[model samples]
Each structure stands twice: as structure tokens, then as C-alpha cells.
Target: MPDAHPHPEPSPAHPRPEPFLARTAPEALHDLRARLRATRWPDAPEDAGWSLGTDLAYLRELVTYWAEEFDWPAQEAALARLPRFRVPVGGLGIHYVHARAVAPTGPVLPLVLSHGWPDSFWRYSKVVPLLTDPGAHGADPADAFDVVVPDMPGYGYSDRPTGAPLDSIAVAGLWAELMDVLGYERFGAAGGDVGSHVSRYLALDHPDRVVAVHRTDAGVPRFFGDPAELAPEEHAWLEGGAAWGAAEGAYAAMHRTKPQTAAFGLTDSPAGLAAWIVEKLRSWSDCGGDIERSYTKDEILTNVTLYWLTETIGSSMRMYHANAAIAPAQLSRRVEVPSGFSIFPGDLVRPPRAWLHRVANAVRVTEPERGGHFAPFEEPELYARELRAFFRPYRAAAAS
Candidate 1:
């Protein structure tokens, strides 16, 4: 007789049969628009400028557009053009996109791409196509590989963890498990902002599995024992950066202390959500004082809509509080994996080679002449080239 249990039907040979569609129910958008129209404005001091906070007039205009002209269905259709998948890992339902190369002999080294705060997996949409289909982007066919982009737990379609200690370390573990489940024993990783921090933790904790790691703005803050130990330039950078943080990072502070309270405003009104998020994209990017030049208004709204539609703004921000409670000695145990850094000009603190070497392999560091915190989105070609170069050595070794 044939084996009692024949091999289970092989999973669809193609990992992702269809790209992710927004799938936001029509009622949800109607309710969101209703909430936006019903928002109650708060009074501010006379002569209060953006220095005091987000401009009320600008926010109102944006809200007006969101209600009247913004097209979520159109954006939804655009997203559906790319392949997406969901895999169960660590008892959580993780949503990700897996795009494969066209060439039959293309390398199959898996790559897990992570996104950071004030952004979602959507941030990687532009670069994902380039990485998976290099030939289509005018790059060598040999450069192509399989790409995986996951919406972190409590973000997008992924199931939210209630009162879960879902910090960077925990998330990194989940990524490793996801790779293993997908049959990738070893893989490369890349991220920016909070994504960068998680990528570092992933490489550090699972050095053997992570063949190589790359980050755009790896959020490694300056460490000074005392004021006297700081170099002049380091001190100047710290002071200026601190001043900017104090003036602008109220959201971080709130997220640290009372994320639940802040979530009320974000969840209650779409206009409030727009102000909270759009400001960061404007201030943090290399926009040269023009937000439109860096990102389209539709791009900004799409990011915000992902958060609003999923109702994950609160759980996502809770990560800051969870991490803040951990000590530095515990945070910087030194990752022993090959690492690459792309220091964009607009990062909060641009670390010198010496500083990054202390924590990671620091094999590749590029001070790109252009781009900012959102490097992948603002300069996709530069980002793709740097990533390919950093991982080339490892890719060659794996192939051999």
C-alpha cells in the first residue's frame, strides 16, 4: 500500500499568490471620515507658531482633503499589485510580502526587511520591487533574490499583542522564527530607524542565522561617561540634537510615559492623526524645508491610514516604553555579526566609524551625499546599491 499519509499537498509553489490589498471595509472609511468631520479644535495661545506646535490651519486643510478628495481604494488597488503573505510564528499571525526573482538561476538567500515607527511595512514598497526584480530595475539579473517584508506585531494586518512585552528583542526572535518556518536557515536583514535597532538585535542575538545586516539610521545614541570625556564635535552634536529632541520629540516622551493617553487623540480623530504623523515625515526627512519635495501628500496619508485602519498606533508606540525600561549595559552587549551602516545626513546622530565598530562588525559605512532618515524611500537606487555591495561578500560565500 502507498504510505498511510501521503506527503501533505505541497504549499502553493509560489509563496505569495497575491499582493496585500488594504481590505479596509467600506464602513471603516465612512466612520473615519465622520470622525474627521466631527473633530473639535483646541485653542492655542495668541502668536503661537509651529515652534509652539503643529499649525492648526494646515491640519484643518489636510483633514478637509482627507475627507473630500483622498482615495484609499485607489491606493489599495496599487498595493494589491505586489505579492503578500501571512505566516504563523511565535503564536502570532504575521503578515508579510514575499517577492521572488524572475531568473531561474537567481540566488535564493532570503532577506527580511523591517520598518520603524511613524511608518509601516508600506515604507519598503518602493525598494522591495528593486531588490526582488533587479533586472526590471536595470540591474544585473544575478543581483536578484527573494525578499520578505513583515508588518511588525501590532502593526498592519498582524495580530496585536495585548499587554505583550513586544519589544525589539522579542520582535527579532519572531523574525528569525519566521525565516526558519519559511525554510530559510540563514538570511540577510536591513532596516531604518526603529527597524534598524531591531535589525541590530536580530543579528546580535542570532549571529549564526543572520548572514549579514544593514541599517540606514541605526539609532545608536552617543555614550558619554561625563561631560569632560566628550569630544568637542561629539558634544556639539549631542547638544544640538538634544535641543531638537526637546522641542520636537514630545511624541516620544508621551509614548514613553503615557502611550495610552496619546492614543486616544490618535484613534479618535483622523485630523489629529495626520498632524501627529505628517510633522515627523516633514521634520525628519531631507526635505530642505519642503515636505512635498521629499514625499507626496498621498504617501503621508497612506502611512497614517494604515495605522488608523488597523487601530495599532497605541500598541506600536508602546515599544518605546518597553525599551526605555531596559538598562544600557543590557542594551549594548556587542553584536558579533557582519554589519553595514548607511549614515544618512538627516539622522538624529551620525556616528563616526569608531563608534559603530564598538557595537557591530562595521564592515561597510557610507555617508551618502543625499537622502535623510527615510533613505529607502527618498533615494531607492542609492539604498539598493549600498545594500547589494554590503551583502555581496556574504552572498558569494553562501553560493560557494
Candidate 2:
């Protein structure tokens, strides 16, 4: 038989590498608190619920706590523990934490983990230790992996490029290059939300390199078909979700159409930042009536502060605009790679097994007892267990 495989080359224009620096220290938290305490809050009609969108009174209260009680230094110290590095890929400086397992053995499978909007590399901090050092979590040391978590372009420590389109597909190509640079000839990929879309593209476009792919949210069915041709259940799922999203996705629409205009308030006022992000945590998470139970006040503030300090509010939102221009048909190209899907209860759309089976080689489908959009942070144990089981077969196959 003829050789059916060939390695790919890196893109000519590489992303510029930028130094990773901590913008806020423990002392800065004090200054932020002072600003929050002095905030002149906005007025709202009495009895306004979330329908009015982040009641000013409620936000003021959160910000007051954030300013007075949240510890930035503690969060920074935790992040500093990770071994982070910056690399240039596709004209954007990418920051990633590359944690290798301590096991004395041959190369382990390289896994590139990606994060979505309203999140940062911090989302995976909890999962990284588990994946890279499974023994520490009371799992087999052989289950250890070389974990790579990158802050998507225009997010976190990565440099946001101007006049360049950085959609999910393009970002996938960048991941391929980053993997190549790190000397990983083959690896697995996993992500949720926007990360899911990018991971799909990586597996599809570079099937030879991506041994397996995992995603928390599947792509919208419309990306895979004409509504008229979709199965009745699929149509209902998409339409119902679209209607709800349209009604509730004011943030998405605003971000897609005019991110810069919206960035002003979020970047300037810490209160505005909390109101915008806190609502999503509350509404989208499976926290059993209290978001703080799933996520600490410090956790939420750390993510927000990453955006505010880096001034990435506008750039991160630009992803929505970039993706909007890509046709659904284009986004739906079949990903011919082994895939895994975890359908958490609170996901925007819980795809039926039949629907996902049509898209990729879905080997594992998990119905978590709890958790939502932020799987890694919200339910680390469940997320870690599902990942281990999903990749166990693949890891065994590779060994054989």
C-alpha cells in the first residue's frame, strides 16, 4: 500500500512571543477595594429581577465584597505555582502552562486543553494537577499526561492582534503549530464551548496528529445541516435554543456587533466587570441556587481581573464577530477523528447520542450527575473521571 500519511509544516508568519507578567500584586487589591468602596452606583426601579440585567444594587454589593474581602495575592500565588511559558504561533503570542508528569518513562501523550470566553487559563488550573499527576489524585500514575493549556488568542496573557482575523478554525491551526514546536508528533485535544469548536477543527484538519478529541459542548446542529433536512428533534433543539439564546444573549449580540463600545465600561469599572461576568456564572452554572458554592468569590474575581488588567475585554469579544462571519455549512465539515462528548446537564444544548454519532467517532458519552458550562472548575472530579475513561481506550490502543 502507498504511504497515506505525511507531516505538516508550520505557518510562515509565527506569533510574536511576549513576556508573561503579573500586572496586579497583593497591594493592588487594596487599591481596587478602595475604588470599589467609593463607587457611585446606578439607580434602578424597585423589584427589578435579572430580567433588567444585573441589578445595580446587587452588583454594588458584590463589588463591595470583592474590594473589601477578595484576595488577589492569594490567587496570584496559586497561579504562580504552575510552570508557564510563552510561544509565538500565527502572529500572536500564546501563553500556556506545560506541566509534565514525574513518571520515569517514555514520552506521554501530549494533550492540548483550550478555554472559552468568560474564562481564562485559570479554568483548567484545577484539572491540570489531576491530569499531570494522577497519583496525587489517587489515580494510577500511568494515567499521567503532559498537559498543555493555552489562553486562546486575544484572551488572558496572549497578545491580541490587530487587523487579523482569529476565528476558531485559524486558532486550531495555531494549536497544531504549537504542538509541533513542542515536538509532539501526535496528541489529544479537549475543550468546551468555543474551545469545543476549535478542537473539532484541529481533529478534522490534522487528523494524523490528533489521536482523539473531546468536547463539553457539541456544535450547533445548524452547522451540520439545513433546518428543513434536520431530524424533527434536532430542529426543535436548535430552534428552541436559538429562541432562548436570542432572548437571553444580549451580551453575545453586543459583543458580536460592537465589542469595543461595550468594553469601555467593563474595562474601566470593576463593578461593571463583576456584573457582566457574575450574571453568567449565576445563570449558566449548576451551582444548586448559589454560584458561590461552585465558584469562590475570589475565583470569579480572578477571571475578571485577568480581563481587566490585560485590557482584553474588546479583543476577547471580537471572537464572536469573527465566528459570526463563517457560514454554518463551513463550520459543520465532518471531523473524521475519534471523539468524546460529555453532556453536562446545564449545557446550552444536550445533544442526543444519535446526533453526535453522526459528527465524529464518539467513543464515550457521559451524562454527569451535576455541573454546567465550566466543567473543569465546577465539577473537577466528574470531569477528570470522564476524561480518564474516555481516553483510556485510546491510551491502551496506543500502547499496544
Candidate 3:
């Protein structure tokens, strides 16, 4: 692979990226294992089976495996193998993976992949390599990308904001600066979950710098405009989103309203962390009630373990509170940049074409049969293909 590190700093005042490798100390692992083993597990009624929340029996089994069999060292070693770096962006040390396209047959576009809550850059780990080296993956080398996956503030290895949690727009500003530091004047952006909102802001705020934008979910539907003006399909989509929220939005509401309170329990108890995250992994995936069908025990544990080791569950959730403050006009702003959407069938809610057009310059939209909310992680191959095809026409924008 070609070196993807940024060019020499333009000035001493400008901070340069330092190579980063995530090495958890021995004591941290020891404490994590002990915490998993010492959990004061609660009981669930027989046949409760995910009707209420995380199944106690399944959690116990998962926690037992986490305590005894899961290997953090191996997982950490795998993570370390990626081309990782941390740079000072706006006083915070932001961590990201910068992988240059291998053997490009055409202009290599720079792409930034942002992640959401519960998971960090881990969301794009599998798809990064595929995007960076499409030829090796049985695709046209012209479709290759110089991929950058960053851990948004308060997630993964990035330092948490001290005063105010960064909303999607704030993070997007940081990304524009980060990409500038990495010598990319214009780049494509894509993400899901909270990442989708951040990517939206990137295009909305930096239309001159972002070549194009892509997203998985269109974000939770809300009316910044009059309801009577909306199409019938839009009304149906909004109604579905409301129904889904009543049943499944407790986690997000908690994140927005009381993340700090929930954080303490999740941060202190490994079992609690797993239960909180694993439930979403099951509920929001194409796993059909069997999470392991979508992700192995190792894959699931790696993400959860990163959260535990960093103790970032609280900080990550704080983004919800920050995002809740975005003005209604900003939330309703339609992205003019050429945009694409791949709405997976198993995701939280699928926005109709009219709704997408109402929100974005929807040049392309496809509803693939597989994957869900975590499409990058759930269906990386499909996700990679979605990106390559969507951004192919926009490569000229990045190059110019």
C-alpha cells in the first residue's frame, strides 16, 4: 500500500498527525475481565426473549464468553495493523485511518467515513480496505479511494469535548479542517447513524470543499416544514418513524436527555455496557433475531471493548444532546451537493423517495435487499459498492 500520511506541515503552528496504535495497558484488560465476571446480573422472566429489552439469558452467555474466551490482544493487534494516526484538530487530538488508494486506474478521490454512537471508526474497518483497493477486491481500480475514517469527538480514541458536546455541524467543521491538514481540499463523505447527520452537515456547510455526500439512513424524519405540504408517502414515513420511536427510541431519548446518568452504569459495568449495545446490535441488524448471523462474537466484543477501554460511552452519547440543539432551519436544510442513498431494508426506518428529495439533492437512491442501520459494518461489500458507484462521477470534483 502507498503511504497515506499527510504532506509536511505548512507551518510549525499547524499540528501534524502522529502514527497511532491502540495498546490497552495490562491493568485495563485485567479490570475489564474482572468487571465482566463480577457483574450482579438481573433476572428476566421466562419467555421474555427480547420483548422487554436485552434477554438476560443471552446476555449472561455473551458476558461469560466475553470474560473467558474473547481475546482483546488479538483484536487490538488487528486494529493496530490499520494505518492509524492522531492529529491535533481544534485543540483536540482526533484519531483517524488514512489509507491511500492502491494502484489507481483513474483519479483517486479522498473519502472521509464518519461513524455514529455505540461504534466508532470500527464501523468502517472492513469497508475501508475495500474502498482503498477496489482492484484487489475484483473491481475497477478507477473506483479506488484514499479513505479516511475518523473517530468523532468523544468516540473511540478521540478526546472528548470538555465544555460542550460537539453536534454534527461542529464535528463537520472539525472534519473540514482535518481534511485540510491531511492535504485534501475536497473529499467525499459518507456515514450512517449519527454519522449520517455529520456527513449531511459536511456537505451542507462545506459544499465548496466536499465533492459529494452519501448516507445510509436519511435521519429521523421531522417537520421543519408544514405537514400539509408533505406528500402522502412522506406522511407514512413520518408515522412509521414515530411508531418506531415509541418502541425503540428510548435509547436515543436517554442519550439526548440523560446520557451522563446512563454512562456511569455502562462505564462501570462491562455487562451493562454489553447489554446496552448488544440489544441494538440485534434489534437494528439484519440478524433476524440472531446477532451472530450478522457479526461474530469477536466482532461484537471488539467494538464494545473499545468503548469500555476508552470509557467513552458517556461522551459518545453526549453528541445526542448537542445535536438536539441544532436549529430547526438547519435540520430542514436540503443538501445541494450531488448525493446518494442506500436504504437497507432492515434499517430503523426507510425514507421514501419524496422524503429523500425533500431533504437532499437525491441523484441516486437504492434500497438493497440486505443490511440494516450499521450497513458499513453489516454489509461492507455492499457498502463499498454503493460508495464506488455513487462517487464515481464525482471524482472530478475531488481532483479539481
- How well does model 1 score by local distance difference test? 0.78
lDDT of 1 at 146: 73
lDDT (C-alpha) at residue 57 in model 1: 68
Ten residues in sequence with the least summed lDDT for candidate 2: 3-12
Q: TM-score for each prediction? A: 0.90, 0.90, 0.97
Q: Please, what is the whole-model Cα lDDT of each candidate in the order they appear?
A: 0.78, 0.79, 0.91
lDDT tens per residue, model 2, 145-204: 778899898899888878855889899999998987766678889999889989999998
- Residue pairs whose backbone atoms clash in candidate 1: 19-82
RMSD to native, candidate 2: 4.9
CA shift of 328, model 3, Å: 0.4
Candidate 1 positional error at 20, Å? 5.6
Q: Write the per-residue lDDT of candidate 1 for residues 1-400, one digit (tens) a residue.
A: 5542121221443232233455778999999889888889887777664556677766777788888889999988787777887766787788888776555234545688999888877888888888877778887767766788898988877878876548888889998877766666778999988888788888988888888999886474646356675656656656766786777778889988899899887887778888888878877788886777888778878888988998888888888888777677657577678889999887666776666776678888889888888888888888887877778778754443
TM-score of candidate 1 to 2 decimals: 0.90
TM-score, structure 2 vs. true: 0.90
The clash count for each model shown is: 1, 4, 0
